[model samples]
Target: MTLTNEFFQQLESLFPKAADSPWYVYAALVFQANDRMELISSTWRYVQSTTSKAEDQIVKARKMREALLKASVLVGFPKGINACTTLRKALLADSPEIESELDKDSSLRQHLSRSEKDARGMDFFSKIYAQHTDRVLQNMSVASGGDLSEFAINAVYGDLMAEESRLNAKETGLLEFLACYATGGSVWAQAKGHMYGSHNLGNGKAEIQGAVKICDTIEETLDIKVNRAPAENWSWLAKAEKW
Candidate 1:
């Protein structure tokens, strides 16, 4: 199916625009939209295929393990962590301090119930992000022999920053990132506060509905694999040669 305006808007809602990203950021956005769909689909099957109700909680508790494995395979550790942490930060930015406190304590939590715990598992997904970030820094530092290479460190920094910027432009926080970057100074400060109001998040739900159709298509269509990389050996491959 074609991506609707509503779909792009939903992607933008999650990752606000910033100066650091290239236009191909849209590819990442589409992949993310698809990933969310795959995740919910996987979870549902895990629930439905179980033979007994007693096994439900046991399987559900392992959802993080499942997601983590999927992430390691799909994007390796750093990119996966970067995605999860950025999304978590975006979620917090949307709600902020008192709003988050209220979300935790309010009837919304009651409404979400067990799902809230799964939502919070987004935080645990960041372990790989941190692990890979440290690895990149260490390798590049050693490559430069303890002194930071203006070229090497900046190259590494640029990749990390681009990932951050890509997340800003594609999903939950892009508008805020765009607004703050464009406005600068105190206007930027005010922009952050202005982000709390609601807008249609579009078919994040419908994307879930279409997930099963997309799953088999993924290997051929998207080349996603769930256990493809070991985080320790992961390195940022340059997209092109330096000028």
Candidate 2:
């Protein structure tokens, strides 16, 4: 499956009512992570037309750019770099003025030291993982002899996801889920963790379900088979609603 205009319309229908939500960005990232470079421009055009308005086109572009940057860690830098470059091309063609609005030094994390990134990352990580943060970090430490956990906290969480200049915590949390989902079935465990993180960040059940439905739709449309977890594994989400 190729991304057709019909698929684009279907994807657009799945988006939340809020125009500024990162879910729009996720649509483009999905194709990027899947190595569908051919579809990226069309996807960007769809996203750009729908989300970018005259008043806030620059804001929307920055948010989309930031989401792509944050998702790079999960999907790989090569794809991320290509996606960003393609998106810039699309933006330039469609709205040259908005393209000019972007900052030369877009990353706020570049100015910070390692310790600052760690502190910021830990703070964001604590918010998402909540009570399970310690256990999760401990497991990562044990699994990788501490290197993996430290890198995850300091680099991924602190340096990337924690950056709120454009995408906020809630948006980044949802982006995590989308990024993992786009990578396919191999990382469902990580995807589920981010789904829970979305919940922890105050995403309602309906909203999370909408995101999942979008992923399911994309997989089906693309004729891609992902080994998604069984329904029983998601029962906790329903249970958590009561708690």
Candidate 3:
């Protein structure tokens, strides 16, 4: 879909300007977008299927699980503690396939089982950002209306900012920033607030320049400009929190 004026205005309400991220961040944006879509899509299905009270809900839940699990591999997002205890527990409670697979993933967790250890192990951000990264996650969770919780936030970002990651925080933040921008909805604004507020992005004008470049990259990659027919407008992001 084209990025509409309404969307941009809503985004600027929170972010003020586009950010200039590193090259790897640009690349990560594409894959991250796909991962985020996988998350959004699967979440909807899980919600719909679970509340249906139909026998076939399991079938649908199973399919959604497949997609979400795959997305996790690509984006390195471990299902958060809340997701695990709530939806994952219910969905996998009786399903052998889901249980067996979730057991092996190592990313999904039923509680904040590894956060402190993960935090201690991390060496990704410099001393300052690393120390304060969890605070950033708290801010993001609050801005996302709790859709992105601390556990879920840590599962995904912990790896992204890990000491040995191929992608640096600057790169991670840029792609992350663009991924939020691509959402083109209220979530986009929230995403922008969290990302722009984070420390990984370039300072001042670099971010603005990066925003322009990110938009251009989106155009080139999608082979469609946000200025074109505006394609079917859709912006409501799944409340990808509980499930």
User: Each prediction's Cα RMSD?
Assistant: 19.0, 2.6, 14.9
lDDT of 2 by residue, 1-243 (tens): 356677777776776666455566777677777776656677766666765367577777778788778888889999889888887888788778777776354557768899998998899999888999999999999999899899998999888888898888877888887777667556766777888888798776656666666777867777767665675544444533442
Best by lDDT: 2
Model 1, 43-98: lDDT tens digits are: 33333343245343333323222232223322345544554444434334432442
lDDT of 3 by residue, 1-243 (tens): 333344333323333333321332232233244432332333333344334454334444443343333223233454422232344655454455545554565433343446643563244332325456577557757988865644444555443333222333444444444554544444555454435433344434445344445555544644633331233322222221111
Q: What's the true lDDT of residue 152 in model 2?
A: 91
Error of 2 at 95 (Å): 2.4
Name the weakest run of 10 consecutive residues (lDDT summed) in model 2: 234-243
| 23 Cα displacement, candidate 2 (Å) | 2.8
- For model 2 the local lDDT of residue 184 reads 55
Candidate 1 positional error at 150, Å? 19
Q: How do all models score by TM-score?
A: 0.22, 0.87, 0.38
Ranking by TM-score: 2, 3, 1
